[model samples]
Target chain A: MARVVVDVMLKPEILDPQGQAVANALPRLGVTDVSSVRIGRRIEIDFTGEADLDRAREIADKLLANPVIEDYEVRLVEGAEVA
Target chain B: MARVVVDVMLKPEILDPQGQAVANALPRLGVTDVSSVRIGRRIEIDFTGEADLDRAREIADKLLANPVIEDYEVRLVEGAEVA
Candidate 1:
């Protein structure tokens, strides 16, 4: 089995309200000194056999991520460990 | 500056409808992937001056992640990269 990890985040130019919400909430929780926060997505795909990284990248670039506003990176997680 | 990365995912036993939705959408996108998909969150925190990892972990455990139904891991990103 192959485990592919895709990390997707909004572009720097875009405003992330979700991240802003988290950042605003931090100080209320007595967690200070944080300058900023950005929230993104981590997608894990488990392939039964012959985990193909290229196909995973295709999937990420095409359907998994919005290339216009977001950026994504695809990589193989060691040991193909998925629960 | 310290860049902290927090990866949070639903527990294995918990149902992930979002991930299922993504998996179900893949075939329609002409992307055939064998097996399952799990979607999680990646939170990046950028701290100004003297990045402290333990404090970041504390914040993650307390405010960033729900330990009851979700599992989270915290690590320091090479550089404080948060947009």
Candidate 2:
């Protein structure tokens, strides 16, 4: 089986309150060096045949990510251990 | 600034309904070679000083991932383009 990984992140201009909440709580953890935090999605698509970048990209564009608020990157992962 | 990436994924045995929903819709997109789809979270933490893998891992373990259902990997990212 071939695997394609898609990383979907919020647009730079978008506000990520979830990440901000994590950042805010860090001070209590005594972690003072962290400046920012951004949270997003990672999707793994396994193909029964060969890894198809085009198909994965289409899936990412159409189903996985919101183009208006998110940006996604698609790439093939060789020997990925994740199930 | 240094960046750390934490990828949080559901344990292989866990049921991923969200991923299944996407996989079910792929046939309508004219894609049928896919075997499986898994979805998870990707978090980016920026450090004002040097990259701290240990601190990032601690943050991921304590705040980011629920140890019961999720597995998280933390690593330093050099020259990453994502915001």
Candidate 3:
């Protein structure tokens, strides 16, 4: 089996209130030296056949992410040897 | 500024309904080759002084993630010159 990871994040132009909230919460919890925060989603897809990165990217771009507001990248998980 | 990333995932024992929902939605979107799906969080923190990985881990454990049900790993973002 192979695992493909898709990292999705809001575009730089998009507003991320949740990330701002996290940055705001840091100091309240005494995690002061911290400056800013941005939050995103990680989606892991398991494939039973070949480790086809292109298919994963297609899945990410078409179904898993919103291209209008979020950016997504698909990559194979390390150490999934395919022979 | 330096950016640190904290990747958080639900424990294997924890139920991930959101992930399952995504998996279920895939077939409808014609992404049929996929076998399984797992969803998680990726948090990016921008620090001003130094890229303190330990501090980022602490923030993830105490403030950013729920240690009881989720596991998190901290790492420095690639290519944030720290000199």
Candidate 4:
């Protein structure tokens, strides 16, 4: 099986409150060096046949990512151990 | 500034309904070769100074991932362009 990874992240201009919350809470955990945090989605698509970047990109574009506020990158994972 | 990436995924045995939902919908998009889909979280932590893998791991373990069902990997991003 071939595995593809899609990483969907918010646009740089977008405000990520969830990440901010985590960043804000870090002080309580004594983590003072961290300046910022941004949270996104990582999707793993396992193909029954060959790893198809175009097909994966189509899937990511149509289903996984919101183009209005998010950006996504799709790439093939070579020899990546299954989680 | 340096960035650390933490990818948090559910254990292989855990049920991923969100991923399943996406996979089920793919057929409508003319995607049939896909065998499975798993969704997870990708977190980016930017530090004011150096990229600290140990600190990032601690934050992931304590707040980001549920040790019971999730597995996380932490790594430093070298010369990774900002999103």
lDDT of 1 by residue, A5-79 (tens): 899999878999999998998887787888888899999898878778888888888767899999998888887
Clashing residue pairs in candidate 2, if any?
none
Off by over 4 Å in 3: A80-83, B80-83
Worst 10 residues of 4 chain B by lDDT: B74-83
Q: lDDT values of the candidates?
A: 0.85, 0.94, 0.83, 0.94
Taking the tens digit of each residue's C-alpha lDDT, what string does model 2 give over A34-63?
989999999999999889999999999999
Candidate 3 residue B30 C-alpha distance from true site, Å: 3.9
Off by over 4 Å in 1: B29-33, B79-83
Compared with the true structure, model 1 gives a TM-score of 0.89
Candidate 3 lDDT, A1-83, residue by residue in tens: 88899999898788899989878888777777777787899888888776679878877887779999999988888875432
**TM-score, second chain, candidate 4:** 0.95
**Backbone-clash count (model 2):** 0
lDDT of each residue in B36-55, candidate 1, tens digit only: 89999998888876667888
Name the candidate, 1 or 2, with the larger DockQ value. Answer: 2
Cα lDDT tens digits for candidate 4, B1-83: 89999999999999999999999999999889999999999999999988889999999998899989999999999997754
lDDT string for model 2 (B1-83, tens) is 88999999999999999999999999999999999999999999999988899999999988999999999999888886634
Off by over 4 Å in 4: none
Top-down lDDT ranking: 2, 4, 1, 3
Error of 4 at B35 (Å): 0.4
Scored against the true structure, residue B45 in model 3 reaches a CA lDDT of 86
Model 3, global lDDT: 0.83
